[model samples]
Target: MTAHVAESTITVELDGQVRVVRRTTDVPVRNVKANKPREVSDVV
Candidate 1:
């Protein structure tokens, strides 16, 4: 069996201060692969 891994990094800045955030998480995968059509709804 084989497994896949993914990672990402994000940075945010506000006013004159800067902040860095790092995180790693496993992505959820679906056993069955299928494409569903999307519908658009009006929003008020």
Candidate 2:
């Protein structure tokens, strides 16, 4: 059996077992802004 999940995910079942599959694609980034200095709170 197979089922459609959220947009990029899917579920499949066979022989009493189930598996989940997810599709992902790398998105090209353009003109990214420079990183800003993090505050002390930003550190764990």
RMSD of each: 11.4, 11.7
Which consecutive 10 residues in model 1 have the weakest lDDT in total?
Answer: 1-10
Spell out the clash pairs found in candidate 2.
Answer: none
lDDT of 1: 0.51
Shift of residue 41 alpha carbon in model 2, Å = 68
User: CA lDDT, every prediction?
Assistant: 0.51, 0.62
Number of colliding residue pairs in each model: 0, 0
Q: What tens digits encode model 1's per-residue C-alpha lDDT throughout 5-40?
A: 225544555675656555455554455444688888
lDDT of 2 by residue, 1-44 (tens): 54545566657678878888875744443434647998676556
Best by lDDT: 2
